[model samples]
Target: MTGQKPVTIVAIGTLDTKLVEYLYLRSQILEADPSINVILIDAGRAAIQHEAITVSQPEVLKASSASDGSLESLPRGEVVATMIDGAKRVIGDLVNEGKVHGVIALGGSGGTSIAAATMRELPLTLPKLIVSTVASGDTSSYVAESDITMMYSVVDIAGLNDVLRAVITNAAVAIAGMARGYAVRCATPTGSEVRKKCVAVTMFGVTTPAVTVARQRLEEMGFEVYVFHATGAGGRSMERLLREGRLDGVLDLTTTELADELVGGVMSANEERLTIAAKTGVPQIVSVGALDMVNFGPKDTVPEKFRDRKFFEHNPSVTLMRTTSNECRELGKRIASRLRANCVDASAIEVWLPLKGISAIAVQGQAFYDNEADGALFDAIKAGLDGSGIAVKEVDADINDPKWAESIARRLVELVNSKSKG
Candidate 1:
């Protein structure tokens, strides 16, 4: 304990409005662990002077490069944006310096937004907790893809009541404990002397077998595999990790999210999907798995225009619509264009086509079976990559066939090996 670095916990809030609450929270944190260094950051719009405030609102604004005048003069939206930017900068610096072990915040919508934005900028392993009045509602905007823990405040975060006090105390004590444990973990060295190569694999329910086979093979080859579902959020998360340079190789076997993006499916991962690996030049083995259908929430949720389109009720909540030949062609072109325009090294990328079927339901006699559509997709991809150096291979088997899956996995291993050797 004598030579140990003090565990640091950052508490962010709108001090001008919740000064009493923040002070009480700080007291509780320090009381829980006196050795924990707690830094209170004021992210309020108005300037406030308080001895307990470690970082003032002006300092936050200055960090965001918005220190032209008092925060009170800025519009509410602009102020919140500036505060988020400033807090991220401040907290990011602390993290870079290894001073932040944990982060905790309590607030209403504005406070939650600022604190959550800042906390999201920190590492996923670092502990982040937020007590919010709106935690019970849809928190997708607030939490996003980060691992920030959110607890609903039974009452408002205004003047502290018995319930509010209990929540704040619990949050403070929890963060302190987490910070101490995080500090200890950071100090401890991992048992493995050599870090294993990590691969990011994309999957969907339709392509589970393929991903499962590939994942097992990668692990057997002493590689760590992160399998991300092809849902919108999952795809976005995988792309974020790829951009952060957290993965060595990619097995993009389930590209159904692109069909969702090309069509009007709810599971679209947006335009940025599939571009990161190409731009970053990570060894990738891509396939046309699960591109035969677009996803919808329910049978009724399918648009009236698509009423005549082929449909499969995956479940009571999910409906899958078969993609038309035109959509498939467009989707293929998009994928090829993205890779061709962004790929830094063509040798590191390979596209595999499962000629028999791209998804579980696209085989012969299946609900989504459509030879014309599949042919359109395959042809478009080949045409788009005509002059590109990227390799394109075709296999006469379903995407989920064990043998085909194993072959794709082996090819990925070969690519990674070649990259390492080069």
Candidate 2:
């Protein structure tokens, strides 16, 4: 498909409320490319409020009803949840059935929520656009872990006036251009025998040496490594690809997000970060890379609850706190449970515990140093994995040491190659 090729440009909105805006978009798309295919999808629950536009029902029907009653009568939260689920199901069906090439929507709060849910179900590469009034606020909820683009509707989605008309027209043209441009570049990949196997790696600033070294080694060994920053979204996206079955393997170096899980830090990947490789059954290499400290924001951003914890400043923007022995115990327990659950024969998966120190700053007399704290973490892992069959090779080197990095890279290569042979 190319810009010159006929493409599906979805014209979606409450044809009931903004049939004018929807029609205007259809005109803009036609003006851009007369050979384009425009799809009118009715996602609205109620009958369109305007004169009957003879709109047809969607191929995938999504019923958005809340007891067929007034807002006061229905539970608002339940209504939104129901609509979100229906929209996602319908959109998934459309994409799976090869119906929609590109998607465009103009909506308010309800539209933003519903339309975003639908777009979120589509893959990251697809062309998605939303001309929304609520694009101004915390769109994190609607855009969570997806690549849906949003444009602010300066004027409301009510009856279109001069300002409304300009915004809507520009949005439509932008979406049309996206569709055409994407279509133009839609040729199938060639058999160049150069399929770059993508591997996802997690890293934080504290664990720079290990991540930097491992990335270089992996690339040298003919693998493309994607380094995720271990922030809330970064870890979430790493797990998302793991579930989507996109990774050849995973090197979960900086488990700092696990810190956020143990402590109440801002960049919490929670329990999900530790188990992605296990769930996906990928060639996974786990490490206690940056578990020495939990992540937080500015000094004051440290929750009042954790104000008494020992803190170190990575920079003015980043604050780090050493984990307590008790916290380390829980973290080890959590990690062990994941390893045990993902236990496999042939010993492909392993966790390397750098006994000297886990992070650059955790070595003797460094900012995060506390042998007692380190001892607690080590003991917890030993006790938790008493007989789980998960290998725990304790090295006498600090985590950033050359030997530790080499071991990790060497073992991962062996595991991946073993799987390749099998």
What C-alpha lDDT values do all the predictions have?
A: 0.90, 0.75
> Which pairs clash (backbone N, Cα, C closer than 3 Å) in model 2?
1-183, 2-183, 2-184, 16-48
> What does candidate 1 score on TM?
0.95
Residues 218-289 of candidate 1: C-alpha lDDT, one tens digit per residue: 899999999998888788888888888898899999999999988889888878888898999899988888
Candidate with top lDDT is 1
TM-score leader:
1
TM-score of each: 0.95, 0.86
TM-score of 2: 0.86
lDDT of 2 by residue, 1-422 (tens): 44344677765555656677788777777887787788766555454433323233332233433333322344656655555555566566667776566888899988777778878778876889999999888787888777788999988898878887788788878887887777655644565777777777788776778888888888998888889988877888888888788887878877777778777887786556666677656788787777888888889888888878899998999999999888888888777776776555426667778888888899998988988888887787777777766677788888888767767876887877777787
Q: What is the lDDT of residue 381 in candidate 2?
A: 74
Question: lDDT, candidate 2, residue 259?
Answer: 72
